[model samples]
Target: EAGVVQSPRYKIIEKKQPVAFWCNPISGHNTLYWYLQNLGQGPELLIRYENEEAVDDSQLPKDRFSAERLKGVDSTLKIQPAELGDSAVYLCASSLDAVASGYNEQFFGPGTRLTVL
Candidate 1:
């Protein structure tokens, strides 16, 4: 089976522009996550989806960022009027289970590097 898949791999845009990222997780995985990683910092969870429901999104910025996991299969993350601070790597990860069982290993995509000038 294929691992998580992400598009564009890299993106460059000016501040105040809109950008979008896409991700497809592994088959049969019930849990999906979107994370943001600044340089030299660990990935911080932006949102987490259990199937089609967003179970955790406390860290997601609601004003300019939006995300959706449609039909429990695919996901998209969008940043409108992006800022220079938004320049970072956006990572998508998935696991077989949604429960916080501590044993589930998440499969991660290569990540989308966004540069804001």
Candidate 2:
């Protein structure tokens, strides 16, 4: 099975600029998720899409961040007027929700490391 894929593993942007990250989840998976990982902390969920519905996005910073899961496949996350505190790893994960309830086996991408200066 193919695993999650993300581009531009590292990124550096000036404050106020916009940045975007992409993700391609595993094949045949029905659940896609995006999480933010601050330094020295575990990944905090930003959004989760079950097929096409954003079932969970309580942790997402709505002020400047947005996401989408069109076609219920690949997804993208965008940050506009980025802030310094937004510097962190953007991780994408996919799970076969049909085969399991818990995300213990979710496959994670290498992640995109962003730095705001």
Candidate 3:
């Protein structure tokens, strides 16, 4: 009955440092998503997971970013060798189905704000 949960609501690190974010989706949700939002821009999908399989991750930066949703529940997103441009809010959302529609509402966590100096 709980909503999505994320850790370390805020994080600050220097460039080249590594940062990690965690998310726990709502119970019974079958789809999960990770999104990146830059200031004044809408959230863009970084990765999407259906159950334990990663269905989409084209927007994710493979060079320094990695994510995993294990056992179809908890998920983690990591950005290594963080860059100054990586400063933004990382949001985690979950839905009851993969095929998003007007009837399916996605619940979002407060999100993790990462600052790279």
Best by TM-score: 1
| lDDT tens digits by residue: candidate 3, 1-117 | 788999989999999999999999999999999999999999999999999888999999999999988799999999999999999999999998867665578899999999999
- Whole-model lDDT values for every prediction: 0.96, 0.92, 0.94
TM-score of each: 0.96, 0.93, 0.94
For candidate 1, write residues 55-84 as lDDT tens digits. Answer: 999999999999999899899999999999
Better of 2 and 3 by TM-score: 3
Give the poorly placed runs of model 3, Cα more than 4 Å off.
100-103
For residues 19-115, could you state the per-residue lDDT of candidate 2 as single tens digits?
9999999998889999999999999999999887899989888999999989999999999989999999999999887436554478999999999
Better of 1 and 2 by TM-score: 1
RMSD of each: 1.2, 1.7, 1.5
Model 1, residue 110: C-alpha shift (Å): 0.2
Which has the better TM-score: candidate 1, or candidate 3? 1
Ranking by lDDT: 1, 3, 2
